[model samples]
Target: MFLKFLTFTIAIGGSALGGPIDPFGSSAARVLTQLPEKTWLESIAVRRNGDILATSLFYSSNIFTVTQPSVHAHNTAKILASVPEVNSLLGITEVPGSYDEEAFFFVGGNFTSLTTFSTTVGSFKGFKLTFPRNGNPTVQKVSDLAPFSSFPNSVTAIPQAPGSVLVADSFVGAIGRLDLLTGQYDPRAFAFDDMAVPKGAKLPIGISAMRMKGSYLYYGNPSTQSIYKVKVDSKGYLVKGAQPSLVANISSVAPGLDDFIFDPQGNILLATNSPENAIVHVDVRTGRSKRIIGGPTDPLMPDSTCLAFGRGILDTNTFYVSTGRNISDPTTSARIVAVDASLLNYY
Candidate 1:
């Protein structure tokens, strides 16, 4: 655990059980580094070795790894590898215990396939994963296990269950579980049909992001600005008839949802409201939300598109958030912002 910097003070808001933490004034929301120019950061992941991997999908695809200690003495980052000519790289995950028992990284996106990498070798140094084609949609193998079709926009590996992966088919507003060993894509692992999307909510054109905690899988619908929670079975499958519980409803605040992340404590949920161009923090249990950072108030806060937990030196909770003009803007300036996860102060 990274020790909290004494220079930083914690800002508590709401109530301990159902309130929010104010970390805006906390010194942790500092700019860590500006990625290389022309690199539109799309996805980010933190390796167990404390290295930060960021992927860009513009005209081509590239992955950069930031070494520990970050760019500043505050945190460290270094470019590990870059792959060109690959477009639409969207999601990333690290294979547990693959790199020196440190875990390798995996990336998924619009290439008609998926890819993984070993930690020590750098770049596209690992294995290339290919999915079998099933009709019009191209199927790709995840973790060399399950075969899945459709546009897999985001993916998350369940830490408690190895060889198990969760993918969000954003277009269908559905989440599926892939058993790497069996090569089966099971849509029944998620609870979605029960989620209520307003009277006429903009149905999910695609799923943008997903994360797993314990037996629960959290997903975001970018079109409707809603977050959903579903329970998975022992095999890491979504139990049937398990209605999706609403985590947050921000349709009125933002026309589109860009991304969301859970603090280390798993009690506070941070979301980037792209349409309104702001970041909101919500209590995990109560569903109440508060604007901790971002919005038009901060010129540096670009339209936040994606977020990941950044491991800071000395055991601090640092969250790395990616920002862009809009999902369609290929020329938008991209940046990674770091914030103290503990600032939210929830357990």
Candidate 2:
């Protein structure tokens, strides 16, 4: 989903400090590249070699690549691939066991219009992309998921089940499983009332961002303004009796949440609370959260959408974030920023 629901704002409170925390020496957030105006950068994934793959929503639905994002000179993102027929690309995740080559799976769909946040209902599809060492990258359609899904927003790999990933179907309010090798898709693989959008929401967004940690899946529910998690079996199905538990309540920080990435130790969850235009760190153990970077009035990362950690040793402490071009204004441009995560003391 895009910024159509951005008009619904939240009151800034709780542990959400409304000022920028400049712990990275002088600059609080470093802008690596800026896209053209009206581009909404949706989801992000980091390659094994530290390249960043970011998907853009609206018009072209282009996936861009940023190599050597740590460097500050002339670091503009270049187009890598564009999913045809769809106007937007939402969720993207790397295949866990692809050791010989870098492989990824992504979801795309057509919307009612460029400015509308609703999808065309039956226009969703999934694709697989592979980047080999010596040749050009290739992308192929893997599944036609529109029949069983309404809106697929985010994706995460289930390492226990190789070649299988769980897709967050936002409008359907469920987490689905897609098998890349067998072309099998189950739209109701995991569903709970907690994942549903509240009876009357400005936007019918349900499950947005999702990440798998060990045998559990952590996700954000924008409509509920909360984060929740549940245990899953080896096959990526929700455990028979496992109930979703509260991870945190972020209603005070932002009206909704978008996408998030887990810290290296898995103890912290860094999330993009959009519209409110802020990013926060949630402690998984205590459900305590604090605004670490950007804010409602902060120009650093306006309309922040998705986040990902750098892949290399030197840049592992640094994470990259993408912002949506302010949908209400035509002059605003989307951006990709590098944030230093070393200042976060999980203890």
Best by lDDT: 2
lDDT of each: 0.53, 0.76
Candidate 2 residue lDDT tens string, 206-287: 8888888888888888888788989987777788899999989877655658888888767645555456777777878888
Per-prediction CA RMSD (Å): 12.8, 8.8
TM-score of 1: 0.70
- Residue 112 of candidate 1: its Cα lDDT? 33
Model 2, C-alpha of 104: deviation from truth (Å): 0.4
lDDT of 1 by residue, 157-242 (tens): 77767666676655445666666555455653453553223345444345567777778877776655667787876556667767
Q: Weakest 10 consecutive residues, lDDT, candidate 1?
A: 117-126
- Model 2 global lDDT (CA atoms, 0 to 1): 0.76
